[model samples]
Target: MAAPDELFCWEGAWGLPSVSSDCLTVLAYAQFAGAPLKLRKISNPWRSPSGSLPALRTNQNETLSRPADIIIHLRKQKFNADYDLSAREGADSLAFISLLEERLKPALIYNSWVDSKNYVEVTRRWYAEHLPFPLNFLLPGRMQRQQLETLRLLRGEESLEGGEELEKELYREASDCMNLLSQRLGARKFFFRDSPSSLDAYVFAYLAPLLKAKLPNGKLQQHLKSLENLSSFCSNILLLYFPHDARESSGGQKSSSPPQPEGGDYDHVPNKRRKQLMSVLVALGAMLSYAVLTGILSIQHMQKEALEAPPPDRQTLDPLDEDEEGDG
Candidate 1:
């Protein structure tokens, strides 16, 4: 278990999915306002079929096979039934995924090959200047080589002439997708609804990687910087979930007096850790009270019936119970 308010992972350099998932965890903590939850960031050596990275495990003895499984597990812990997704919200999440597949994926495919005269030149120049030497060497060259091999296999040398046309198609698709996203975000504090939703988390994750990419002449950088609200939202969530000590170390200042323990004896040191632990305990007590009041964690017979009901088949694991009957 993590100490209160201690973040298990670092942020900023992480990929889209990881960042978005972290944000979801932060949101869960914020909603509870309870004891800080442990964040176990695993760096799994295995890769998924989609070529994505796998999660690291916190407990050496325990395993969570997939991201969805992790989400379900989190849902079972101190779950707020009020946070359950409605039918419409579920459909919207699916729609967001579909849109990304239709738009972003095609653009990625096309951009790999022939560079776009319109956007490609600008992006290429940017990448050349800002991207790290290793990445620049790997990404563009690999993409171009794959494109050449694909062209050769599909159309022979004759089809090479139409590469520019394919590139143009890709640019069109990507631009269209970006425009749609911008329009959807117009005037609204969030993308999916009034408050941030699961869909928003996914969108933020996918876009964060693109936003973090080195841009030419800092054009893309400037664009992202201008989105103050979005940036603030991201930063606020980070700080809340990943609180850190900010006190400055005093190397120059001399100690006025020797540090003394209570009762004239070297004893317990009063420090931030002790203070944080107390705060966490208090928060936990408050949460238990609220849960009891709301019937969210009630022990009433009828409420127990609902809580004890077997989770739907979609969930492979059984809910943890106070007794052995709940164990899977």
Candidate 2:
């Protein structure tokens, strides 16, 4: 067969470590589309849209500089009417995009909180900052630091505190997403109603990092092992597109064993529980403040009425009677 059409050619880092999951999802979709994908290394990791390096160039001669924009462009192209993209397939793609946006937001907020800086500073610190030692050379180390730092900031701790909570939340959300996919997929091998669609690629891409993540505790690892299909999809994609790296990473292990999926009583909580809790707390605080203000207002109103009411008419009759008696 002739070489498949190349859809995405990325340079340097397509997505920052904070959102690499999304980056992987993008790649998975491209690969699933039977599009040849390649990554060209750049001397500077911090190259921005205005920078000289071209991050993405499609077969159509279109160039995209940002990861978000790149995904958007891909969706529009792949799902275009002329492309005959299926409705169900398009919905999956949209869902992937939505999940990615949700995942990236907190990371952005965490970066801002740590640096108290604008988007540029946060993005630069995340993608371009140099790390110490051998870790500086490894992609995982570079990516890990940014992720850890963001998590630290989010937890408001000096170190990677609250990662448990963060990880839990991530797992919950991802599981919910995956669960939806599982239902749709049922016994089918792919996400598309009939055949494997671009959605599978996106889902796999976003999930790769999680599959590769070296969790300190067995929690996340165990959680991942539970999603058999997701695990299978990730492993299959890694083998196909990144065989050498996958081999080296897998260490010649022949077993079809998936990583032990993390499990706990905590994982089953609603995915957005933390967000909901925060909203409830905010509402409660606002209501309390309003109640206090109303109480103060009521007291002030009563005091004003007491002060303004005409003084009871003074009894002047006694003085008049005294004067009349004196006259008599």
lDDT of 1 by residue, 1-328 (tens): 5433222332222222132233333333333334334544322212222222233233333445344444444455544322656787678666875786566554543443344542354334333333344565455555466656764554335555566575565556656665566665675666555555555544454455445433333333344456665544444433343333111112111241145432332243335586579779989999998888897433555655677654464244443343457453
Residue 319 CA displacement from its true place in model 1, Å:
72
Let me know the TM-score candidate 2 reaches against the reference structure: 0.48
- Give the top-scoring candidate (TM-score): 2
Weakest 10 consecutive residues of candidate 1 by summed lDDT: 245-254
Q: Model 2 over residues 1-328: C-alpha lDDT tens digits? A: 4332232222212122123444454555555554445554343434423332334666565567665566557566553221445666577567765764565334333333322232233333333333222333564344546665666564455564444565456556655666665565566566555444556655565555545643333343455577787777667667776566676555533432253243342333333677578679989999999998989867766776788653344246666888999999
Best by lDDT: 2
- Candidate 1 residue pairs in clash (backbone atoms < 3 Å): 42-56, 43-56, 126-216
lDDT (Cα, 0-100) at 81 in candidate 2: 20
Least accurate 10 contiguous residues by lDDT in model 2: 9-18
Each model's TM-score? 0.42, 0.48
Off by over 4 Å in 1: 1-52, 56-62, 78-85, 106-164, 192-194, 216-328
Q: Any runs in candidate 2 off by more than 4 Å, and if so which?
A: 1-19, 36-38, 42-44, 47-54, 57-63, 72-84, 103-170, 193-195, 251-328
What's the lDDT for residue 91 in model 1? 81
